[model samples]
Target: MMPLVHSLSADDEIFSVSVSHDGTRVAASYNDAIMIWDTHTGCRTLGPLKGHEYWVWSVAFSPDGRSLASGSSDNTIRIWDTETGTELLEPLNQHTDEVTLVLYSYAGTFLISGSDDHTVNIWDPYTGNLIGPPIDTGDRVSSVAISPDSTKIAIASFNNTLRIYDFATVSPILHDFTIHVCDAATGISIGNPFRGHTNVVTSVAFSPDCRYIASGSDDMMIILWDAVTGQICAEPLAGHSSGISAVVFTSEGSLLVSGSRDHSIKVWDVGAVIRRVELANGSNSIVTQRIDLEITSVMSLKDVVSRLTDWGCTDMSAELDWTSVGDYPISQGGFGDIYRCKLTDGHEVAVKTLRVYVDPDEQTRKSLKHAAREIYTWSKLKHPNVQPLLGLVVFREQVGMLATWEPNGNLPSYIERNRETDRCLLGAQIAEGLAYLHDLGVVHGDLKGVNVLVSKDEIAQLADFGNAVLREYTIQFSKTSTKHNISPRWTAPELFRGSKYSMEADVYALGMV
Candidate 1:
């Protein structure tokens, strides 16, 4: 409720402000110059570090707190030595129009800039040389942000859309609007866009941990987003009375600072916002406790059932008796074997059982936990294009997941047989299913043609949730799964670099399918 920490006034309309990594100093863009102020004393420490020919629009501090970067209407980016108050290099003159935003990657490996020329460019902050070809967004860019891992770049434009690009390849992978979290390496949209803003988003910053994104909008509001799930983390912070020009989180990510066109800068307590949300929802602690239990305790079948029930899987009590039709499994999956089975109701189903080891080692426990997670995620979904979770069955002393059996089998086999099938319609259906999952904050981490089943009606139903994850859960839950074993053919480039399985990664896989 009382999140504000400081309110520093400036003499002129402030365009952008960046806080030092140590939170000791702040840099503000004023007219054609940049000024540095002591965050605690509100006294000018350095600057009027003047080199720009026109209005300076953006400023950023390097990760080490020794360098500053500024972009201006002069169509250039300037890196300044923070200690000496001197220019570090020749102006970075790559853009053809006013530079709108400047940002440094969390590791200070590279600097990114957005310009009114409708382009986003990457620069080697040390040498003042362009790292790659500029990415064309086809609209005047408003802001740019680099993910903490430095594999992705997010570009916001006047067109009201955010485009994500792979930092390594410099190729666009996803485009959407109203603020979005994207895969830095594949440019695939991570999840549904953050949609609370009523006007153009002016700036965005990713927390140092990459768990949250803070966005500032012309509507004079700031929204904190759960970067993993694309859910608003807290109620909108609405102290600014005019359009917000910039927003950034301190290196520790415990504080957020914002600059407004009203010539005022505000600092906010990021922890307070999170604590407030936790108090309102009463679920954050519950999720933490559940994650702790899964990681620290070797769970029994009864424990798994109890956890599932707590997550709203009451249907586990359904009295449907089922048995495998043959002595062998029809197919093998990542964590289990799939068998064709018949229910007591005379309905056919596919049953997947985890390959539980009798010795119950740590890996075995993790595999069981993943199975429970898959069941919990799938049970909550109810879309026509998404495969339905029927119930659970015990097979050979192991718990198995049951789902409606598709007569037509997986997509590839169905497509091979029905060559004349409407491929476009199937793709649309698959997209719809993925979109539905994303809307519910789920990531179908291992999306591929084989994971999609086709029914007698030729409807594409997404299945195989062994690799699926609910984004609302902590990242540790997803890390426990065998994500590394996912086929590289459909995996996003970022995931290979050790990034978490994300909605953007799922989108990349969807494109592959």
Candidate 2:
């Protein structure tokens, strides 16, 4: 096959580059200006944008091709009205230091820019207004990209960490990655630094569909990242004999063009290059290095709260309880006491105070079992509707299980109060809970209404897994309670036979409900 066609030049060292969505116009940033040129004509320049005070580091065209944004060492981002050749608004002036890069998200609704100030700022391009809180990176944020679907933001920083943040909150969805690291750090050295050109990262651009991010470096390498996981997916694009100046994804999404200090423009068939690296060596070279965060896979709030409960962690909002509140003192379960304690932070936590002062000989075995059964299980479960185990609270004779509080009470209470209305809904919720547990390869051997909690929304969650067992894994249930809706009327036939419970058994009980 013909190698992807690219051109070369030895003239002005290009600092930054971007292509219009139609693949017709190309813009390059140099010393103090941006040069707009026609790709097909190979013309010297269509126009020169001359407003930056210092070196312009990056430039990007708006999705609709009507506007252009440039970031500069002057500590400002400028939005120019492309059609009118007039400055559209005052420079977006929030960076504490030089603005390093500017990019229009795929939708053109927001402009994201990174700076030498160790921050990434977001702007509403239409009104030239700051949109959300500036993301604090704690180190120079080298590059930023809003994913194609616009749900994620990837920020590569000088700390050698790639932080994946949720677009909605700008909170870290995933953190502490080593995709593009500063050479100063001590870890596994990425052999020869993608051609050994020495410098920090300077630019990052996502593929047209946002599947990959192309990051340019002062080191002269262009590394492509799997946008989904924030991991490196290709070997360093190393044609540039000097520091790579800019990296851009073509509008057609098939090629990535990079400009370098060596004065050459290289076009790459992204598919061939990435596929070779991905399938080479039997596994992706960067799979382990890339941290992929599946935003769309996030569970609902209910699942989040539920997981906290299952893990014995309290919600950040629960009321703090110093003294026990109910008519009954905190009751003890198989592993610990379920104290209804309010956290100092006002969140209700199911403090499972471990039975203190256990016999020494039994401690090791019991601790091992508890670690495997409770802590490990809680840590792995991530779903919105599932209760999350926030953390452990330890006391003299007890370990507290701080999880979310289900205010509406358990399934039995809701069933007794709501009767007909709650029955079908609660039944469905119980089924869902069972399905979730099974999906995670768990079987709540003691599945029943009393072992289930009902949220205010009437959603049912399977609880009290003290007697739960992993399907096909032999761990006997120490003890269990039968109360309210889990009485003989709701008990499955297998329970009477002392048969080990399975998801099918949970379904049998759910059907009873």
Candidate 3:
């Protein structure tokens, strides 16, 4: 496809380019300077705003298009007034190494930056104050982007991983090179990572509507991702002859502009691309469901609890005292929080409650049903390598599952404590637990080091059945309902290709563990 508007030539190599929210102005950064151009006439409206001591790697426009932010190899970030071509405030110099990328939140409330210093920093654009401590990514940061809602931040780094973190809590949730979607609030990875690029991913951007993600790679291709299902929306967008340096969707999301090392900028008509992909697939519609907004299961909280009781699982809600439960959760996950609590019988247990922040009515229902399904599956297991489900309790007006609290914590923490511990035995115990689950026709869909807990006896036990399902009866439910609960780094390759979780996939995850 031909670019809708390609009208800029630079004597120097362009490191990055950004389009204003109004889609009228374009900002390009190169060799210690920034320039602004009129989109239609290709006229340079603003020139060579030069103050940086070294190469400027990134430039971005605020939502209002009145200000521009640039990051440079000088290890500084500067804000520039778009109209007067003057530097705003002081140089924001928190990074210790070259600043690679800078981006403003969709609301223009704060600015985010990534650097070769291996940190991602959040700053207030107006006051130029650092928001919090810098996030230590442990690898040189390459590119950074904030989601449309401004709740999550996605950082691509030199370590070949793209990680998503909650903007409010600064918790790293999703981690993988293949592009995984995550729940911003609960830090749970949603579905599999979108995988198609054959080379390193260079940049990623989310649409204004938060429905799609566009990623550019060294493979000279741009892939659009369905934000809800973590699926590739269309075929690879191929036009740039050299590696793509940057990509951005216009404020309205109708046009996508890409910059390349080929010294060219190409604007793609996104609507036309979608239309062509749909026609090629012989379908009028591309998206079948919005997983976040829709509920696919018919089971309700009442039905789930009734099924659990019918199956002879203990319901501790009536017998347990809710006052003994901890007032705050010790840890949090996508579906809920984990709290250490004590039973009236003097035994200690970990209580996990559903943590739903949005769409309380529908989400609570779905979460309750999911929790109940987990309880049902967990109650069927009785193995030494698996954590046993003691019972179900109602606390804080939410249903929580109870299990024996392992003092040694998860596998990662356990290994951190005992560096000389035998990992082979831990791996074997994990395999034993997984084999037990598969023998009973259950697929532990999500498995990772974090999901493996170390008991006081120094034994590895499998926990967290939020994604487990009975193979014969729930093939479809496992494929669709809990699809978002997967951890991409530990996920089997076939799951990324749309295969349902099976015993073979479980074995593959065991290998990853």
Top candidate, metric TM-score: 1
| Residue 205, model 3, lDDT | 78
Where model 2 places Cα greater than 4 Å from the true spot, the runs are 1-11, 161-163, 167-241, 263-513
* Winner of 2 and 3 under TM-score: 3
CA displacement after TM-score superposition, residue 271 of candidate 3 (Å): 2.0
Superposed Cα RMSD, model 2: 17.3
List model 1 lDDT by residue over 301-355, tens digit each: 7556666776667543354554435788988755578888777777887788755
**Cα lDDT, model 1, residue 34:** 83
Candidate 3, 343-449: lDDT as tens digits: 78877789876442213455455554455555666775655578988887555655578898898999999999999998987887798678667655578887888
**lDDT at 275, model 1:** 48
Please give the range of 10 consecutive residues that has the lowest summed lDDT in model 3.
285-294
Candidates' C-alpha lDDT = 0.76, 0.62, 0.74
- In candidate 3, stretches whose alpha carbon ends up further than 4 angstroms from where it belongs are 131-137, 143-177, 183-195, 225-236, 278-513
Best by lDDT: 1
